[model samples]
Target chain A: MKVRVTVMLKDGVLDPQGKAIGHALQTLGFDGVHDVRVGKVIELDLHGAGEEETHKKAEDMARNLLANLVIEDYSIEVVS
Target chain B: MKVRVTVMLKDGVLDPQGKAIGHALQTLGFDGVHDVRVGKVIELDLHGAGEEETHKKAEDMARNLLANLVIEDYSIEVVS
Candidate 1:
């Protein structure tokens, strides 16, 4: 089975990297760009797990290791 | 308008960060985890653009500055 996790910074958190990217885009002449927030995605392939089990395990992974809970939020999807 | 870009490393590319994350997850006792790959998402809020224009600009942003075309693939979505 395949599990996909989307992790994103919580609102109100300072995202310097995102700010830098936005600035860079503007400098590159992409003036249409405004607010930019950057997040991450983690894809995992697991063997010997059903959909329910895979999602539970992936959720645990996200909570315990994949994301900083106080600053980031994560959602898991069973992709396959 | 809101646009989102998902950037991912191409298959066969070495992802040291992903490897480290997987190793860490294993260390944390999530033994079900395997084959972890990490990517990124960028959300952009733009004003004064229609869906077509927003998507086009976001695609250009991804192709030129948001992602490395040689090693990564990017997809743009009009979120709002």
Candidate 2:
């Protein structure tokens, strides 16, 4: 199975990288952008796992490794 | 309008970050994972733009600033 985990900063967190991107976009003349938030997408390919088990494992990985729970949130989806 | 751009390494490119994560996952006993790829997800909130214009602007931004076309590929999606 293939699972994709999206890890993003929590709503209240400050994202300097995103701010920088927004600023750059404005400077480059694409000025309609008002907000930018950058996040991570982790795609994993697993073998010997059923759909249910794969989802569980991916969630476990997100909780333990992919995201910093204090300031980040994650969502997982099975792609294949 | 809201646009999301996902930027990922080209299929044959080396991804050391992903490999290290995979190794750590195995070491931590989540051994079903065989491959991993890490990518970026950028969400932008734009004002004063129609959906079609937002999509075009996002594609332009991805090509010009968000992605390195030589080694990465980017996909844009309009969320709202």
Most lDDT-accurate candidate: 2
Give the runs in model 2 whose Cα sits over 4 Å from its true position: none
* Highest TM-score scorer: 2
Quote the lDDT for B5 in model 2.
98
Worst 10 residues of 1 chain B by lDDT: B25-34
Residue A3 C-alpha lDDT in model 2: 96
Q: Model 1: runs farther than 4 Å from truth?
A: none
DockQ-derived CAPRI band for the predicted complex in model 1 = high
Residue lDDT tens for model 2, A15-38:
999999999998899887889999
Evaluate residue B33 in candidate 1 and report its C-alpha lDDT on the 0 to 100 scale.
68
Summarize candidate 1's per-residue lDDT along B1-80 as a digit string, tens digits: 99889999999999998899989988888786679899999999988999998988888888889999999998888999
lDDT of 1 at A70: 97
- Native contacts retained, all candidates in order: 0.90, 0.93
User: What is the DockQ (computed on Cα atoms) for candidate 2?
Assistant: 0.92
